[model samples]
Target: MVFEYILKQNGIHPQNDLTIDQSIDFGSTAAAFAGGNGDFTVEFEPGATSLESEQKGYVVASLGKDSGYIPYTAFCAKKSYLKENTDLIQRFTSALQKGMDYVQTHSPKEIAEIIQPQFPENDLKTIQTIVTRYYEQGTWKADLIFEKESFELLQDILLDAGELEKRVPYEDLVTTTFAKKAVK
Candidate 1:
């Protein structure tokens, strides 16, 4: 969705019927599904029950391209909620940090093993490859840096598409304090 927003900022609409048919190859998964890319050629299978078919002509790009986590719990809150529910926000922030810590500390092999039995048809090496790619770009930021960047990129696209009427201050859209607090 971030990339889609960025593309729109650049005046490149995925659904625009232009002479050129450019595809944004987002592989299948739950998030991708929600972001409106679930119909893409590649996707994650549930329970590894089916034979893995290698789809030709599709480029495989890792989602961890500049990967990082957004503290939606902190940034997505209404101003009133943030002001009144700091402790709840902090606890959610801490949980995200813990998950990131686990990912950071775990080896690709271990992670592969953990997820492998459920998806037995897929290769462990492939899973490990995905896990490593995620680790390389991923970080848990309570400040929501990546999400802010994504939104900024999206806003730019919206503006280019004339979907937005004016410039929105990026700093006004997201908070950085929670990430700063969590890191400390």
Candidate 2:
């Protein structure tokens, strides 16, 4: 929800004029293929006005009231490998930063063109909707200000999920050095 916080901090209301909703199904490969075509015969439609008793259609609904949140998994890197190949980590991070920059600067139509082919079933409109929402304000901000409120919210969610034993202090978990350099 870092995006939400950035917008809110700048007086952009995510909840007031606009509504927040997740995809019909969380990262469904099949649904992605059938996007907005009403072709799934099973997948829900985009912004569906009403539900039918028995018919192939889509459903527009709140992300909440869903069964469970997506789980967070950790991938550990071998300490020896990391220590010997620090450059690999740096390169990967740099590449990601460059990609985020490209996405931010490109027009939505341009971005849409690049993404459309991946999901042949999804009309350009559906892909556009997803891209606009995810990359809304632009740059993924690899070095953007590490807003404590955002992390705190994440920690709270994890705690509620019984994933965290005790909350860590902001200083222990995040650093602002990169963000400080970014604005300069």
Candidate 3:
């Protein structure tokens, strides 16, 4: 959906311009591209960096940087559950906001050092490179707020893809109250 939207935005018809190999699963795309399966590939984070580092692929483009605002990650909970656990949700959201703040304020290498424990398989330098790439690409926001404009853009993408039958209003699915009140 994202790739198709990007293609259309750039005046390229996804269906008519080129054949995008949808056969490769998300995880295997880097390896497949490395094996000469596709002319180009869209990868996120470590995969792209790893590909270039391994001399299999070249980092050419950034879809997210070019795609505009995307509300890719959200902390979702059932309304009932949310109502029952507002305090817990607030704390969770607050923690996430802090994480965002940390990413925004710290250098990529510094952030990488702290997060290296989470990804033990990757060496510190690789983690730093990945962090630098994401940081440079503006992947992380300084806050946890899911803006209405981003929601609308997502709906537009979904509508263009024929995945959404009707446009859902942002208020119906989003609430910025928690994010707004989240401890800074």
Candidate 4:
């Protein structure tokens, strides 16, 4: 959807000029593009970075850097669950904020070494590359607040893609009350 949004911004409608071939996952998409299965495919890091490093695939654009602060990931829960587990949510957010802070202050190589246990299959160099790219791009946020402008950009993309019939107000969908409390 983001790639489609970017294409529209560049005045290239996927429906008219480009053939959109859907892939099951990012790695497969990168592999397909690298193998000449498609001219282009949208890939997220570390898959995108990995493809360029290992497969000689060229990156035409970076969605994160180019799109200007689109919030692609979020820690979400059901309304009922959230209502009941507010404290737990706050603790989780606080811990995440601390982790984000650590990443922001520390070197990407150090952060990668700390996280390498979770990704045993990937080598240190690949992990370092991915972490460095994300860190440099400001992909991770220390604050949990869902920025209204970023949310609106996501909504606009969805609306343009016909996934959303109407614009959903930010207040209705997101609450920063717990995040605010967590930050403090």
lDDT of 4 by residue, 137-176 (tens): 7787777788899899989988998999999889888988
Clashes per candidate (backbone, < 3 Å) = 4, 2, 0, 0
Candidate 2's displacement at residue 28, Å, is: 8.5
Better candidate by lDDT, 2 or 4:
4
- Model 3 residue runs over 4 Å out of place are none
lDDT of 3 by residue, 1-184 (tens): 9989999988999899999988888999999999989789989778898898899988888888888879888878889998999999999888888888888889999999999999888899999998898898888887888998899889999999999999988888898988998844
Give, for candidate 2, the lowest lDDT window spanning 10 residues.
65-74
Clashes of 4: 0
- Which candidate number would show the highest lDDT if scored against the true structure? 3
lDDT of 3 at 130: 86
Tell me the spans in candidate 1 whose CA falls farther than 4 Å from its real position: 1-75, 113-126, 136-151, 161-163
**After superposition, which runs of candidate 2 have C-alpha atoms over 4 Å from their true positions?**
1-81, 137-148, 169-184
Which pairs clash inside model 3? none
Q: Rank by TM-score, descending?
A: 3, 4, 1, 2
lDDT of each prediction vs. the true structure? 0.53, 0.51, 0.88, 0.82
**Best model number under TM-score:** 3
